[model samples]
Target: MKIGNLIRLVIFGLLLVFLIQPELFAGFFGLFTKNNQPAIYNQGSLLDITLNHLGIVAAATLASTIIAVGLAIVVTRPFGAEFLPLSRSLANIGQTFPPVAVLALAVPMLGFGTAPTLVALFLYGLLPIFENTLTGLTNLPPAVTDAAKGVGMSGWQRLIKVELPLALPVILAGVRLSVVISLATATIGSTVAARTLGEVIIAGLLSSNTAFVLQGGLIVGVLAVLIYDALSALERFLMKRTGQLGRA
Candidate 1:
């Protein structure tokens, strides 16, 4: 294996160790803090919180992608072109409104737990995915689209087989960004009583435990970097399959 792959494995191994057995690093965590207490997030199992965190992010990203991509497809269609501005404005509203504000507003109606967090994350993730989808669809080569029509393909067939396949790289790019952002942002969900890694950091803040804060931050950071690299590899693979990478 390449050295880079080996390094990635080491990083992933350490992150897994931290998640599954954080106390193993207590001695190391003690070096940073004056207090001799073991640096650990003991309120709940780290693995469970991590799983919950990932699940919430995945669900929110999936929902946002569906809505954003569907809206993009609709507005880009000839019959729906007139709604582009309205669709753009509506999508922008999510990004325009602060996530914290959305949480504050949503919690009143949705009431605590994961519901409000889902709404906040879904809204927070919409703009990038929607904009990327719009860009991908609009920027398709005219000749390529013309060729699809020349082949006697129906509009639906052209979109499904040609346009969507060509646009997928850009769409996945948007999804990647959303997923990474959601991974970090989901930590905030714990404030509203949702199970997440943020709970570890928040608990540390409330009790002045630097160890808790560092561990929580480290876990989330590591997860983001690993996921980003993995997605980048996937994107490159897709590009390669589509002959987009070799041309350049």
Candidate 2:
């Protein structure tokens, strides 16, 4: 494997070890504490919290991807072109408001759990995916699209067989951005009673436990890095495959 890939693998392996047995690193982190107490966050299982955190992010990203991509596709179509401005504005609404504020507003309706977090994340993730999808679909080479139409392909056929395939890489790029941002943002979900890595950080903050804060931050950071690398690899693979198919 290439040196960079090998380094990522090693970092990911160590992240797994840290997540699985965080207590093992207590001694190391304890050195930074004032009293040098054990650097453990025992309020809940790190594994379970990590899993829940990932679940929330995945769910939100999936929902966002579906809705955003659908909107993008619709706006790019001849029949729906007039809706482009409206769609863009709607997608922009999410980032216009702070996620924490959204969470606060949603809590009254959703009653403080995964729902509010999901809503917030879904909204926050929308803009990038939508914009990228729009860019991908709208920026297609006119010649290629014309060729598809010349071959007697219907609009739908041209879209599915020509446009979408060519646009997959760019769409995936947006998805990668959304997912990585969501992964970090999901920690904030804990403030609204969602189970997430933020629980550890919050607990640490409440009791002035540096170890707890560090542990939580470490997990989130490592997880983000791992997922980012994985998604980047996926995007590269898709782009390569799309290129090969185009040549064929």
Candidate 3:
């Protein structure tokens, strides 16, 4: 009901309209320029592709968030600080590795389809989520920890009741970043016969049909926008509800 929400809705409507009916806008303006081929947008293929892509992305993201954040928590204390740099280095290496190379090496073991792609996506998601989780929990005010101790709260109780809630916003923002990255990386799954929005783009690239590429890329962008926007809104809502952040 708020004006900001209204504006978000309006923008979403416009994006949906264009994504669902790209030809309407494409035909209005001459955007396709490839090998002089007629533009084509295959709806069924696009839908199937996007769905599979989202599936791989979601699985990878969920797995990465669990593993990365768990490890981050394990390595943050005085006794564990020695492990912090190692954990961070591994995270950095995960991001530095080429997903294409990962896929190539994994293909022999995992075969084709979504499995290898899932591994690559999972690896890509680990660093940001891990770093964010660590930073969020560490940023807590020392006074809050003291207050928890003064109340005779157990360590786990302090973590669950105070740290987790206070750190949730930053963790959620990290999740948002991983989500967008996941959506984009899912496109690469198409190389291994895994369905995704990248199918059209790759097909276009191979066949010299620019419209096909444009359609796929645009749809992926639109989906990313929708998912990120929703997550961002959810983050804001939770932060406000927790009283950890001021309401806008």
TM-score of each: 0.96, 0.95, 0.87
Comparison by TM-score, 1 against 2, better one: 1
Candidate 1 regions off by >4 Å? Answer: none
Residue 227's C-alpha lDDT in candidate 2?
89
Predictions in order: lDDT: 0.89, 0.90, 0.81
Name the weakest run of 10 consecutive residues (lDDT summed) in model 2: 239-248
Single out the weakest 10-residue window by summed lDDT for candidate 1. Answer: 31-40
Candidate 3 TM-score versus the reference = 0.87
Quantify how close model 1 is to the true structure by its C-alpha RMSD in Å. 1.2
Note the residue pairs that clash in candidate 2.
none
Enumerate clash totals for all models, in the order shown: 0, 0, 0
Candidate 3, 14-72: lDDT as tens digits:
65666556566656324676555656665354545666778888899999899888877
Q: Judged by TM-score relative to the true structure, which candidate is superior, 1 or 3? A: 1
Q: How accurate is candidate 1 locally (lDDT)?
A: 0.89
Model 2 TM-score? 0.95
Ranking by TM-score: 1, 2, 3
Q: Which residue pairs collide, candidate 1?
A: none
Over the stretch 34-86, how does candidate 2's per-residue lDDT look in tens digits?
Answer: 66555788888888899999999999999999999999999888899999999
- Top lDDT model: 2
